[model samples]
Target: MKRNNFHTHVFRCGHAVGDEERMVQAAIENGLVELGFSCHIPMPRYRRHLLKGTIEERSINNIPSFIRKLILGGPNMRMPYSQRHIHLKEVQRVKEKYKDEIQIFQGFEAEYFEDYQDYYQELLDSNTVEYLILGHHFDRSSINERYYGRAILEDKDVLKYASQVVQALETNLYSYVCHPDLFMIGKRTWSPACQEATTQICKKAKELSIPLELNSGGIRRGLREIEGVVNYPYPYDEFWKIASEIGNDVVLGIDAHFPNNFKEENYQNLELFAKRFSLHVIENFTFRKGKSNK
Candidate 1:
């Protein structure tokens, strides 16, 4: 239970309280030795609909230009300002501030959707990024273009999207696959066919030495229905059964969007579930600083 937490989020990616110092303080208070800050990389462009969703929100009202530029990508969509020197400065500041207390690493949760392989490779090759994690919330490559909200709308594109996930994992570039169980909530129900597909993916993950995430964040703050009902990300029994059958590696990600979101109470239920299945805890993983030990 006492170990490092490597998948913390930061404020730049729409988090309300993911400031560097605040994150470090939270880790220290939690007695974590190795804390990693993995902010979401700015998407090539925020989807247009997202602009309508939060443009009038009070907190981001002051920096409307910044947020708009983020969506528009302005003149630098390919190499935007989000990937500029500011990230380096912030990482350096955090490292210097918490030198001995915690080993802070610079990382980004990159979206490995379609047409992003080169850009992601550039980021990985830039040498500034210490880790690369996958956040495949909405399949960017799916031909159907259905977002998480419409996951239950079955289509052949679903298979293509799932295969794309396998292809991305084939690259062996991700530190961890973020939220693999994310959209299972909206599935019609646990089906043998779905379980078979998941088993196949897990088999590949195991072969490629990639760790599939057990994301607490998905369970904690799930997508809401038009009727205001909250949907859990995955059924615990289904996940355990599939994982046990596949025998793939697993890692715990708090997927914390807000500060103090990974506290004992927040993670307790999932932790208990993981313990019951004997899933691997990623905190004990020892990499070569940057390169994965696998």
Candidate 2:
């Protein structure tokens, strides 16, 4: 029972309290070998001016309205902290300090958009990033353009979305698809066509030997949508069924955006999914080479 966690986040993305060094200590104490930090990428277009304050001290409502404004403005807006000095120094410091104690790979939880294809291509081409995790923050180009945690994928958009996902997956650029089933939940119903499209995408992933993630955060958030007998969020049954049928490799992503989120209940539930699906658990799969020692 190796303890490895690949999908994780840091303070820069917003929720977690402690920074990378503290997280590494927790991971070591918890008997983890690999603990990746896939923070949200810097989208300069999305970065709006905000009143700076400590995330822990700031009121949720009073935190800032910039996120909403940026979302409303569309994807062209760059990511917050794209050029922010503080974040740059923080990431560098973490990497330098923890270089010997834990594995710390540079990564991003990428947003899926038609425009994202180009942006991600640039990212992949850079060769600086070790892993890419596709987290569908928005379903379509139109509508609210908001970053709702719930999946809002429609049947008609399924093919296109699936195609973009396939491209992202097959590119051999991404390490895993974070919260891969976000679209299956939400207001849009999954149709026969959508399922078929997904099946194709799964097949492609299987061929590429890319791992599809079974995210626990969605389940923890109590956002599971009921579709037939399979639960939403990760859609374990449907997802596992397809993966098993296609022999697709599966990864369990806790998506632990917060420190307190790494708990027993959710870990047990995720393990149950692995057992139910007979999926391999790649615990302690460190992306950073030297970090697991200390």
Writing each residue's lDDT as its tens digit, candidate 1 over 140-204 gives: 52112334424573434345445756877776567777776544655645555566657766777
Question: What's the lDDT for all of these models?
Answer: 0.61, 0.58
Candidate topping TM-score: 1
| Model 1 ranges off by over 4 Å | 43-80, 141-146, 149-158, 222-231, 285-294
Score candidate 1 by TM-score against the native.
Answer: 0.77
lDDT of 2 by residue, 1-294 (tens): 555567776665544556666666666666565666666666543422221222322433322344553454322222244433454455567667766766555666775554445566565565445556777555433123333333454565666667777766554556667766666555345468657777977888777666777788867856444544446455446656767677766777777666656665667788887778777555432232111121
Residue 285, candidate 2: how far off, in angstroms?
7.7
Residue-pair clashes per prediction, in order, are 0, 16
Every candidate's CA RMSD: 6.6, 7.8
Clashing pairs in 1: none
TM-scores of the candidates in the order shown: 0.77, 0.74
Candidate 1 weakest lDDT stretch, 10 residues = 285-294
